[model samples]
Target: MDQQIIMKIDDLRMYFNTNGGVFGNKRKIVHAVDDVSLSIMEGETIGIVGESGCGKTTFGRAILRLYKPTGGSIEFMGQNITDMPERKLRQLRSKMVYVFQDPYESLDPRKTVGSTVGEPLIINHLVRNKKEYEKRIAELFEIVNLDPSMANRYPHEFSGGQRQRVAIARSLASDPKLIVFDEAVSALDVSLQARIVNLLADIKERLKITYIFISHDLSVVKHISDRIAVFYLGRVVELSEADELYKNPLHPYTKALLTAVPIPDPFLEDKRDVIFMDGEIPSPINPPKGCPFHPRCPFATDICRTDAPQLVDMGHQHLVACYASQEGRLPK
Candidate 1:
């Protein structure tokens, strides 16, 4: 596997001032993403797993320049892209595509599948003429296991899973090198989700595409990711190899998340430590002072609530942000 870095984000922060400064009191701001940084390696899938409103989607959008980042720099293949001009960014969009969460909502209901998939080719001028364009759309349909005959039909004609396949085909239309999977399978049924996940796995193996797969579903992330980054309220609490994360989560928040996954074997389920967090995720406008997880962490200490923990290396590419992880005091 190549160790080259494809995307590098340094001290990334995306905040929103919900109230005016000083008078209305600069009281609280929504820290959508706060002082977060991570690197994405070429040809590897980096799974970002977190609960809803944890800023996983914001992080992805920030890197793609979908939102002008409040702070920090985003480097794409070594080119600084945090503040690139619109024209250059438009050109770069081809190399980095985004697959939206809801296939039902993402597709334009007005457009035919043929027209929807072909839109990229037309915009990028990848194909020469109308005939060649139609042929290319047909090819993409075959690539995603969709019947070519259905190309003429609108999005409403397709099943949820089939619509997602069309969505995948649309993303592949530009032959992207780095694709963002934003909750790509969350909207589908269980069987359909499995099919899409398997499809992505096969496509990655064949095309060597690097991905930033964001999801709350740890099972899917574990199945598809080479590495996993667990986020909480805009900050990453842990990052490690996929298998390692499931089998040996370091951060308290990570362990809590793992405990939430249902075990199939009744015997094994009985032996696993079950963690039930007490509160809903605190508001982004006024997140806790210390470790974001400290508010709900059963093992939190006085220091954990007063001072924030920095992401520290815990050997072999595993990193965590809890005091326990830093001091090697974590539970077995």
Candidate 2:
């Protein structure tokens, strides 16, 4: 069976212009998301993972048109929405939603949780009357494992996890085809994180909704993502199936990231050699001439320092953008 493409992004670039000089006279561009192209299929969750300032969140926001992209194109559900007017984009928003990391900030303090959840329904005119709105609000709460009666409570009344659940319920209230979860579980406690991750997986299965799960924690992403894309600075360094990425990481940076994730077994953890890359991530404002990751990559060569390598499929649909990998110089 051929899968339907939900979103198609080509050479997506998002740049932010800011004042640089001490006098605030010089214009400096922050390449938040640079030349990123990705295709998302319906009913599949694609994970975007990278360290802080790697443009993972920006990429997600760009795809949803939350930010007016400086360059490139974004096609959603077979329609080009990259330059769609705000008035028209508002109509399309019902099919796409964003779940922010901090529920406390996303939810209103004065309104009841029910009101917050049903805002989408009101905007989209999904309900005919107050009775339908109330009933749908209850159903949304129940879907996220929150009691329908709790809808009357305020955001301050709910715990962190519960508040996040409320936020999730609100996102689903619109019956969106795509949801962007930006560090949704990173702020929760370990146990809470596990429960929310499981809940997200369950929701995806039952609803058959596509997700863009953005996080720095590879372990959590592994559980929910069908495929993973590793970002560095403002570009994707590697992309592959979840299992293949964990088992055989082609890029040097990908290998380093996997090594950082601790194994559950103490004995095995002690025996494993962790690959520690030198130096911090480069500044996106003035990224390295060649690869964005070359500054910290241990396997960097002269070509890696002079020329950027584009993403290439080595095998099994694993795409990597490292000169070392392309030249077969990556150590086994």
Candidate 3:
């Protein structure tokens, strides 16, 4: 049997217009996500890692059709949805859901947990009557390991971890095929984050749900992802299997990111090679020419300064966009 491709992104771009431009118009574009392409397989988690402004969240929103793409296409289950009509998109969204970073903010204080979880089922007509809706809500709560009796409680009544579980329950209420976890565990404590991550893994194994786990923390992403995509300034600089990328990072940006993740053992941590990235992230608007990371890359050459590199396969399911790596010139 062949692995199912859940989502395909082709040259997707999400640009925001900044204030002031040539004709006194807000034509200065901030390249939030630019010419990025990747595919997601069913039943696997894909981690997107980068600094805060690298556009991972924007990419997720664009994939979910929450933000209209300025260019390129997004295909979900082999169907093109980049320009799909709103009515059709709404109907299709039942299988595509998002679990936001802050559960407290995602859930409305005015609504009870039961109502919040049942809202999607009711709107999509998944349940025939109120009793059935309530039953489904209870099931959702149970699925996330929450007590069904607590369905009547409001958002304020639950702890942070419990609130996140409620958000996950709400997302799963409609039996989604894919879930975008936009830093879903970032706001929780370390212990709570671990539990939630385990819960997510359990949910994936039981329900076979695909996930796009976005976060800046390498450690967190490493723990949950099957494959990882490293983003820089609005573009994906590298992508590879989680272990392969962590063990052998090809792109300069990726190398820097991995270096920053501290090792657990004190001796290993002290002896580990660390690369300090100089200068801050470049502005998306009026970004540097050629490779976006050339300005800060230690191994940047003339080619890197003059031309951007495409994501090229480097064997073993690894892909990188860097002149040095492609030329086998990357330092050992």
Candidate 4:
């Protein structure tokens, strides 16, 4: 059976205006998320990976209507929500939620963990009485592998990992259908990250929830994602199944990112050649003409400097946006 598409985004563009001139009089537009389109299926975990400032987080927020997109359409659950009014959008908040990067800052220092977890339930009117609320809070805490007894404590009392678990608990309080996790485990240690990733996988199986996981760490994303999208300068450069992307990356930027991931086997790691990219990422406010990655791509051609390449399928559902890949100029 074909899986239902939970969310569909078309030509999603999110631009930000900021003062740029010396006198602060001129307004410059920053292309945070430019002409990106994707479809997320129900019960699937789609990972968005890229360098810092590549619009991974912005894309997630834009789809969730946390930031009103400058252009494009966002359809969630067969409803067009791209320009939905705040009042109407509020009603959908219970079904779609965001789990921020910093658990420390996301939680209130003054509020107890139990209250924090119950905030969504209270706002969505999920529970009727105090007893029902407490029972739901306990269930949420237990789902995240957190002790219900610790719910009475403050956010500052818990460790970074524990705090993140608390945040997860809060996000699940209303039984959301789709959750966007922006760098959810980036702040924790390696061990904690693995544990949290495992917990999320377990929860997804038990609850049948859909997730959009955004992060710059490809290694971490590989473990949790079913399909991965590689972003560069606010656009998707490559997208494919997680294992397929690692096995055969057609885009230069994707190849470079994979090379940077350290292999566990010392002998194989030493034998592999690393592709080092030249130059820094271009500023979003004044991005270069033509292809966004042409300036740093080693295989860039004349056409690459004059015309931007759109993402095209290269068989087996692997999509790439490189002129060299399309023209068969890149070495196999």
Candidate achieving the largest lDDT: 4
Cα lDDT, all candidates:
0.91, 0.93, 0.92, 0.94
| Poorest lDDT segment (10 consecutive residues) of candidate 2 | 17-26
lDDT of 4 by residue, 1-332 (tens): 13899999999999999967797678989999999989999999999999999999999899999999999999999999999999999999999999999998999999999999999999999999999999999999999999999999999999999999999999999999999999999999999999999999999999999999999999889999999999999999998988999999999899999998988999999998788899899999987888999999999888889888999999988999998998787766
lDDT of the structure predicted as candidate 1: 0.91
Task: State which candidate, 2 or 3, has the greater lDDT.
Answer: 2
**How many pairs of residues collide in model 4?**
0
Which segments of model 2 are wrong by more than 4 Å?
Answer: 20-24
The residue-by-residue lDDT of candidate 2 on 68-156, one tens digit each, is 99999999998999999999999999999999988879899999999999999999999999999999999999899999999999999
Q: Per-prediction TM-score, please?
A: 0.96, 0.98, 0.97, 0.98
**Candidate 1 residues 41-123, lDDT tens each?**
99999999999999999999889999999999999978999999888899888888899999999999999988999998988
**Residue lDDT tens for model 3, 1-332:** 12789999999999998778567875678999999999999988999999999999999999999999999999998899999999999988999999999988999999998899889998899999878888899899998999999998899999999999999999998899999999999999999999999999999989989999999999999999999999998899999999999899999888888888878899998987777789999999888999999999988899998899999999998999999999999886
Q: How many angstroms is residue 185 displaced in model 3 relative to the true structure, after the best TM-score fit?
A: 0.4
Task: Give stretches of model 3 more than 4 Å off.
Answer: 21-26
